[model samples]
Target: MEVGEMEMRMSTLSGEQGKEKETQSDEDRGYDENMSDSPRESVDSTNETPSKKTQLEDGSHSLSVIKKAVVVLTRLPEYKVSTLRPPTPQQFYSEDESHSSSDSDMQWEPEDNSSDSDFSVTDSKQKTGKPTQNDTKKTPAPQTMSEPAPIIISSAFAYCANEITKVRPDLPEEEVKVGMMVLARKRHMRWQQGKIVEIITRKDGRLKYKVNFVEKGKSLVSGHHIAFDNTPKLEQLYVGARVVVKCQDDKFQSAILAELPTRKNRLRFLVFLDNHVPVYVGLPLLHLVCRPLENSLDDIRDSPHKCFMSRYLRDWPYPHLTQYSAGQSLNAELNGVQQRCEVQEVDSSLIHVVFQDNQHKEWIHRGSIRLEHMTRFLELKEIEDYLDDSD
Candidate 1:
């Protein structure tokens, strides 16, 4: 009877264990049916929590890096920070850098914003792949053509005309008149005595004198090229007379009359210049030096004539010797017109100048050059003073 009861108990326990296993299997099947019904939701639900945690960790890492960069920037100087940053429009397009982009076709727009503007410009450039007017580079404007200043014809002849008129007041009206006996220079010939028969007026209203010479016949001459026929007496210019004569160096030197004028030499006197041999010079080239007291030739020679001659030669009266130098620009007379020239070489009394217009080179007397800047300055100052007076 006891053995039968034990078997019944064992059967009951086994039946209970089977019922629990069936219940666990039914729960697993229901779970699989829910996963199949919304597979994406199940997968997302499983991944969502871990992804959130990972994102939080990544955000913390980025924040730490940004904070570190901010701290480093804060420790740096303002100028250093600015150097690290991109340049502003004004800073980029400065005068010193303007020439760098002069040939570039890109245009630039000025921005008042901070670094954000730079990013926006970069984004725009990347999107369009072309430079716009609002870009960083710019094309400079086309320069305007300016009308040149008027060409001033400042000639040496003009200066001489004014100086000669000041020295001889009668030259302008009395000597240049018609029916005057004057010395006129002929073409390719020496100056000859002539009588002004008629005054001819040109189409340009310039007065020209028609002179009849004894040997050269009739010829037209300019008034300035003619001189009054007031010939000095050759007898009065005695030996040892102090005179000034133009030497081979184109400079007027103090000379002593070694011999009196003779008709055989065409009334030219034999004169001795300082440090030079005796030379025959005509009356036109000889200027006599007058003394207060009359002295004989022997007395004049015994006096301090050498000392006077040395001093006169050393310090010449002409201003051009000291004023002009090589590479200096001035206006000089070429032919009959005034043109711009550069001094190629300067000698004692002559200047070798090259014409700027035609590159023609010629040796000109130092007196023939006129400084354009000086004349222009004088004119401008005079005009300004006149305007001030009028006001």
Candidate 2:
């Protein structure tokens, strides 16, 4: 319901930053801690070694030695039992090469050692001071995201009342997430009213939407493309109509269909001030009314942006007047009297006209000059009558 200023621009959310925010909100607290506890404990227990076990190169160890190690490890404080030893760079590279070589062999083998024996071997392995290879491979930190792209828009005039609205400025793009109501103009079509269902990216690098709206229990619209306009103010938008879309000065050029993706759809229209900078527009009437002398109502209604444009160009009961050109030479005729005038000047109002009657005389006001009488009466007026009266 808020009206946008003429300078507003529409933008949208996209890319990794947007995805991350959505993911963070869906994550459950405590879930990570609960899942990691058991795994941490198992890893710690396996790393424990007994002092009695003699470490060997063949990877074998005695059962009694492992049992003694477990008992001793259990008696120790939890903090002392496990030491976090991260691998050195040289050892990490060596292990990585070894694993890579072994993986290519594609042969699976079962261990002949008992669980107790394996535990002692692991303990002895820990005593040797070698660390896990994973400790060396650090994950790269996440990078900061860049800003979203700006919305592009164009301008056109309204052709009809179906696109008109009293709503004024439309909403902002920040407020227009997926699932908000919007107004759009279809390419080569009338302005349509609809709500957004999803925002999607196209192969052509423009962001578009899957919109949903109903007309009399039937779906009126679905996935549609949108473009921008420069005429309407940012906040006010044409609501509930489809429009023919025009991109360049040539109407023959191809263009995408468009609507407000959300209530916040802001666009730029081309304003011929100095250079072509972006200007915002809302509703069709405001565009026409603001520069009525330069723009016409029919031109707007028929424009590609008309669905939204039409919404502003509402019909009125009264007829408006505009000046029309008249040819040179005022043939003077005054109230059934005719005469030739040497020089003339004239002034006109809605109800009357005043002009010099010729003979280098002063001007006179003609009462109630009707459209039908203008030409005929001009043929029969006297300039001398005004001059004689003045004398």
Candidate 3:
């Protein structure tokens, strides 16, 4: 029993001892927890002041970056700006402007004269760039030709009488007088147109004149003459009178009389043909014609036959006879008998005749058949027809 009791006591003591140890361990755990809570409290306190310390560190870092940027900017050199600016009004006046400015700006003035006001506007406009009325005028173009008028002879001399001188085929009946002036075709420098001093006809049946003042200190002479036979009529002209004359050598043109001749004379010549035959006698050509054997001056005297012969001789134009009536009558009378004569020769004096019969032809001296016989022969029809056929 004793041994069992000892064992039970020892177990109770152990149980009590474990309870005390457990209590002491609980106290020690509480102390260690308190000690651990103090460290956490200290951690919370440090956490509360950490924001201030963090702000101070951030400020120091920002200050350091600003100081670095300031140092970088301060190390660079200063920059210059290159720019252009307009000049002011003061600079414009500073330049030399004598040619651009007026004298009024310098207080200069003209004298107060009336003419000054007239030119003032003109001068002002000229200085201010404007044209005046006179400045706009233009010069005219020049002319290129120069000539004079012509003088006709008729208009120059009008005192001369008009009369027919020498007529032409194409021109009108021209006038002739002592002082008539005419243009000369052959001698242009001679006194073709001049004062007539004297009129004379030559032995060869030509009229000439003594002309005066044709050239320098001298006179001119020409072979040309007037035809008295062809003059218009007695009433148309007279001697010692002023008249317009035509130069025969010219193509028959007329002009006024420049002067008159002091003398005039009739020209004389022997009749070359039979007196019984009428001949055309012009002082210019002195033409003559013989009448046929069968006709007489009585047959042709009052006849235009004289005029016809005159025109024929002077190379003028006139009407022709329809037939040779005298020749025809003579030829009819000797037709069958066959004793007819043919004219063989004709000259200024005589006409030789030859008769041709049935047997043979023979020559006969018909001695200048009287102008009356020639007239009859020319008038015969058969003779005229035979002459025409033979010609």
- Candidates, ranked, lDDT: 1, 2, 3
Across residues 1-391, which tens digit of lDDT does each residue of candidate 3 receive? 9779857866775676577658756755764555522112112222121111111132344211111111111112223111234556876543333234322211112122122221111222224432233432321122431211110001111122432122211323444456644332223212233455665678987556555544433243332322222333333322211121323354232111111111110221112121122121223322111111122222233233343334222321111111121112111113224244544543222233344454232222111122223223233423545766999
Q: Which numbered prediction scores highest in TM-score against the true structure?
A: 1
Q: List ranges where model 2 is wrong by over 4 Å.
A: 1-175, 216-322, 325-391
**Which lDDT values do the candidates have, in the order given?**
0.46, 0.30, 0.29
Name the lDDT value of residue 299 in candidate 2.
34
**TM-score of every model?**
0.25, 0.18, 0.15
Error of 1 at 285 (Å): 3.2
Residue-level lDDT for 194 in candidate 3: 43
- Backbone clashes counted, model 3: 25
lDDT of 2 by residue, 1-391 (tens): 2224311311121343355445644443333434532213333345443333333233463323443223111233456545544556776467544443211111111122112111111111122232336532332222431221111111222223423232333354334347565544433333344566676677886555655643422132323323222234434433322222332342211121122322222332212111111122223422211111122223332332333233223311111111222222332345445443322433321112233454344332121122212222221222323554789
Order of candidate numbers by TM-score, starting with the best: 1, 2, 3
What overall lDDT, based on C-alpha atoms, would model 2 receive against the true structure? 0.30
